[model samples]
Structures are given as structure tokens and as C-alpha cells.
Target: MTENKNNRTITWIVGGILILLLAGVSVLLISEKKVNKELTQEFELEKEDLENQYTTFARQYDELKLTVSNDSLSSLLEQEQLKTQRLLEELRTVKSSNAREIRRLRNELATLRKVMISYINQIDSLNRLTAQQKEIIADVTQKYNAASATINNLSQEKKALNQKVTLAAQLDATAIEVTPLNKRNKRTKRTKNIVQLKIDFVISKNITAQTGEKTLYVRITKPDNDVLTKNDADVFAYENRNLRYSIKKYIEYTGEEQPVTVYWDVEEFLYAGTYRIDIFTDGNLIGSQNFSLN
Candidate 1:
């Protein structure tokens, strides 16, 4: 009977030890499960943060493309943007438990960020250079305009001075006289008794006048305002037009006061009225006179 009691005690101890061991195993399993849950939460948070960074990086690349002007640089930015998008898609597809892939994408994101910063700095430098070039062009244009204006003003002044010099160099005629003469060279007053007309003038002394040969033209108009010319083709230029003259004479000018005389034979019928005489030289009317005969 005692032996039977000892065997029951041993059986109880073995049963208690098994019960405690099972309880310890249950506790260990619960703790391990809690730890696994916490680790999973951490991985999910990390993946979400990485996704946010990748998405933001892609958006920033698009923004950078807009600020770039160089065609090659813009194309490069577009390529980088596509790469960022591809990486973002990969990240989205990756399981939260994939720590290795998540870490790799995070490294790529860092590299992309550094590249974006470099592009931004380059774009800024290019913009500054463009601004400086514009300023220089504006300055040069302004100076060119000023120079053109000055040249125009100087040309106008030169033209005006040349015109004044031309005017000062022209000859002046004075003391003009016209007389009706008979066939005997005596002055007459009656229109029927006159057979010739005498014209006389004096060129005033001018140091500026050209000293050379000159041609003189005399035009006589009757009371009818008809010019008397021996030939219709006896013409001279005046004010860009041809004018018929009654008499032409040639003389040598010496830049000193000189007297000149020209005669016209009265071949046409004379009338009883006023007559006018004009003398021209060098395309300019130098003297004029009026007379009357009965």
C-alpha cells in the first residue's frame, strides 16, 4: 500500500511539471507574437514614409523641368522624372515586409534629390547669365541710337553751311540800263524810230565770286508779254526748265567790278507800250529793267 502511495505522488509531480512547462510555452508564444506585430507596424510606417518621399521627389522633378530652358537639360530632367515615377511604382508594389527593396529605393531617392539640387543650381546660373546679356544689349542699342542722332545732326549742320557758302559765292549785278537806239546808234524815244535795243550792266566786286568764263542771257518782253527770240531753239536752262533768250553773250570774270553791254536788233514789229528786259547768268536772274516807248 505504501509503494502504491509513492507512485501516485511521483505521478502528481510529473503532471505539475508538465502543466508549468505548457504555461511557460504559452507565455513565450504570446510575447513572440506581440514582437512580430510591432515589427510589422514599424515596416509599414517606414514604407509609407518612403513612398511619400518618392512621390514628392517625382513632383519636384516635374517642377524643375518647367524652370529649365536648355533643351538637353529639360530632356534630362524628363528622363529623371520618369525614373522617379518608375521607382515610385515599384515601391507601391513592394510588400511592406520587403525591407531590402524599401531601403534600396530610399537610397535611390537620396541620389535623385542630390541630382535635382544640382540641376536647380545650374538653371539659376543660366538665368543670371541671360539677364546680364539682355542688359548689355540694351546698353549697346542705346549708345548706337545716340550716335546715329549725333551723326544726323552733324550732317544737317554741314548741309546748311554748304548752302550758305554757295549763296555767298554767287555774282550780283547792278546799274542795269536799257535804251532804244536808232540805226545811227543815237538814243531814240519813239518806238517806230528805234531799230535796236541796248542793255548795259555792271557786276559788283566780290572776292568770293568765281573767277572764270561766264555766259550771259538777255530776255526782252514786249507789252504782250511775248519774249522776243531770233530762234525758238535758242534756249538756256533756268530752274530745271528751258527759256528762250533774245541775246547771249560770253565774258571773262576777274572777281572785280566789271561792266557788260549787249544789243538786240529790233527785227520784230514794235508796238507802242511798255517793254521789259531781264539778264541772267549761271542760272540766276542777275538784273532787270523796264522802259516805255511811244
Candidate 2:
């Protein structure tokens, strides 16, 4: 009877061990399933974040196109933009459980970022160079304008100096006298008795004037303001037009005061009124005088 009891006790112990092992296996399986679910959730979140990054990179390429003016650079940016969009589409279609594909796409995102940074640096360099060129052009233009203004000022100064020199070199006449003579060559105040008129003048000394031969014109006017000339064509230049003169004399000037005399024979009828005499040289009126006759 004792032997039988020992065998039964052994069987009961074996059965308890088997039941404990099955319960431990069931707990292990449940824990493993929970861990797997958490891992899958983490992978999905990572994939969503990666997709967002790719979308943002694509949008950035569009913005970069707006900043570039070069046609070749714009074309390159367009290619990059399209590439980023294609990668984004591929990322969206990929299963979250595909870790290999997700990792590869992530590496591609890094490479795209590096390429975009390089392009940005290139664009910045080009912009800085263009700004420098504009500054140089503006500086050159300002200097040219300053030089032109200086030249104009110099030209005006030279013209003014020339005008001053011309004025300083002009000849002047002074000490003028006129005497009416009768048929006996004697001074007379009677207009009807006058047969000739004598004119005398002195040229003033001027060292600046040219020392050479010069022509002098003398005009005599009657009481009626009529110029006395031998012929209508007896003319000399005064200002810009020709004027009738009673007498023309040639003299050699030595830049010294010199006395001159001229005469006119009265051929027309005379009246009792004031008469005038004028002398000119080098197109300038040099002297004038008026006298009364009876």
C-alpha cells in the first residue's frame, strides 16, 4: 500500500509542473505581441515625419526659383524641385513596415539637403558680385560728371579773359577840334561864307594797342543831319554795316599820342544851324564834336 501511494504522489507533481510551464509561455507571448505593436507605431511616426521633411524641401526649391535670374540656374532649381517631389511621392507609397526603404529614403533626404545648401551658397555669391559691379559703375559716372564740370568752368574763364584783353587793346581819340574856313582859308562862323572845314584830333597813348598802319574815317554832318561825302558809295565799316564818310586817312601808329588833321570842301548849300563831326577807327567810334554856324 505505501508503494502505491508514492507512485500517485509522483504523478501529481509532474502534472503541476506541466501546467506552470504552459502559463509562463502564455505570459511571454502576450508581452512579445505588445512590444511588436509599439515598434510598429514608432516606425509609422518616423515615416510621417520624413514625409513632412520631403514636402518642405520641395516647397523650398520653389522659393529658390523666384530668387534666381540666370536661366541655367533656374533650370537646375526646377530639376531639383521635381526630384524632391518624386521622392516625396515614393515615400508616401512605401509601407511603414518596410524599414529598408524608409532608411534609404531618409538618406536621400540628407543628400538633397546638402545639394540645396550648395545651390544657396552659389546664389549668394552671385548676388554679392552683382552688387559690387553696380557700386563701381556709379562711382565712375560720378567722377566723369565732376571732370566735365571742371572743363566747362575752365572754358568760361578763358573766354572772359579774352574779352578783357580785347577791351584793353582798343584805341581812343581825344582833343578834337573843328574850324570852318572861308575862301581865303580864314576861320569864319558864317555858314554861307564857309568854303571848307578843317578837323583835328589826337590819338591817346596805349601800349596794349597794336603798333601798325590803321585807317581812320571822318564823317561830317550838315545842320539837316546830312552826311557830306563825295559819292554815295564812299563808305567804311562801323559795327556790322557800312556808313558814309567824308574823309579817310591812313596813319602809322607807334603806340604813342599822335596829332592828325583832315579837311572837307563844302559843295552843298549850307544853313544856319548846328553841325557835327565824327571820327572812327577799327570799326569803333573814337571821337565826336558839334559846332554852331550862322
Whose TM-score is greatest here?
Answer: 1
lDDT of 1: 0.90
Please, what is the whole-model Cα lDDT of each candidate in the order they appear?
0.90, 0.91
The C-alpha RMSD of each candidate to the native structure, in angstroms, is 3.8, 5.4
| Clashing residue pairs for model 1 | none
User: Which ten-residue region of model 1 has the weakest summed lDDT?
Assistant: 164-173
Candidate 2 local Cα displacement, residue 43, angstroms: 7.0
Which pairs clash in the backbone of model 2?
none
Write model 2 residue lDDT over 1-294, tens digit each, in one string: 999999999999999898999889998999999998998999999999999999999999988988898899999999999999999999999999999999999999999999999999989998898889889988998999899889888889988888888777888878889898999999998888999988889999989999999999999888878898999999987788999999999999999999999888888887888888898898789889897788
Taking all chains together, the TM-score of candidate 2 against the true structure is 0.64
TM-score for each of the candidates: 0.76, 0.64
- Model 2 has an lDDT value of 0.91
